[model samples]
Target: MIDLALNFAFVAVGLAQVLALVRLVRGPHVGDRILALDTMVINAIGLIVLVGVKWGTQMYFESAMIFAMLGFVSTVALARFVLRGDIIE
Candidate 1:
């Protein structure tokens, strides 16, 4: 039963990743695309966490944490660039 649940979660997250990629590609505006990219990052993080849970390992969780930090920083940088045309002084 647990394995079944994990498999279902993996499939759901994979589908979500594909849909987010579609949004990233077909978004009508730059901001929309950026948001879609962020969504994809979030979904990726969720997938990583699920893998960690499935495997009963610590490395996946650590990798997910690092990926999350990078995702957050990139999203903030992108939003700032869009708003101000510059990410740094």
Candidate 2:
């Protein structure tokens, strides 16, 4: 059923978010932590979309889009900082 599938997706994404958080905290390298943070952002977006589907609302979709854009920018900035020792030159 569609409802069952949605529930399963939610559970899977939730677990993924938790694991990503663990990796973010325990990762040995800065790059690994950054990757984990990116993964967490993706999982958060998945959760937002799932909530929008369940509630039949359009607002969550907009929120998800905004979050995605911000996540991307932040990730790029972090990567740049790690590589160049500064985000802005």
Candidate 3:
């Protein structure tokens, strides 16, 4: 059933977020931490989409899109900062 599938997806995404948090905290390098942050962002988006599907709502999907865009920009900025030491040159 769709309800069962949705519940499973929610649990899976939550677990993924937790794992990503652990990586963020225990990462051996700054780059790894940045990657973990990106992974968390992705998991967050997944959770958002899942919520949208579970509720059959339109707003959550739009918010998820916005979050995805922001996540992409932030990830790029973080990676740039790691490589160049400054987000803006």
- lDDT by residue (1-89, candidate 2, tens digit) is 98999999999999999999999999999999999999999999999999988888898978999999999999999999999999889
- The lDDT ranking, best first, is 2, 1, 3
List per-prediction Cα lDDT, in the order shown: 0.93, 0.95, 0.92
Comparison by lDDT, 1 against 3, better one? 1
Worst 10 residues of 2 by lDDT: 53-62
User: In model 2, where do residues sit more than 4 Å from their true spots?
Assistant: none
- Residue 20 CA displacement from its true place in model 1, Å: 0.5
In model 3, the worst 10-residue window by lDDT is: 57-66
Number of backbone collisions per candidate: 0, 0, 0
Report how far off residue 33 is in candidate 2 (Å). 0.2
Question: Order the candidates by TM-score, highest first — what do you get?
Answer: 2, 1, 3
Say which prediction, candidate 2 or candidate 3, comes out ahead on lDDT. 2
- Per-model TM values vs. the true structure: 0.95, 0.96, 0.94
> Alpha carbon lDDT of residue 23, candidate 3?
93
Task: Judge candidate 2 against the unseen true structure and give its global Cα lDDT, from 0 to 1.
Answer: 0.95
Could you say which candidate leads in lDDT?
Answer: 2
The alpha-carbon lDDT assigned to residue 56 of candidate 2 equals 82
Clashing pairs for predicted structure model 3, backbone only: none
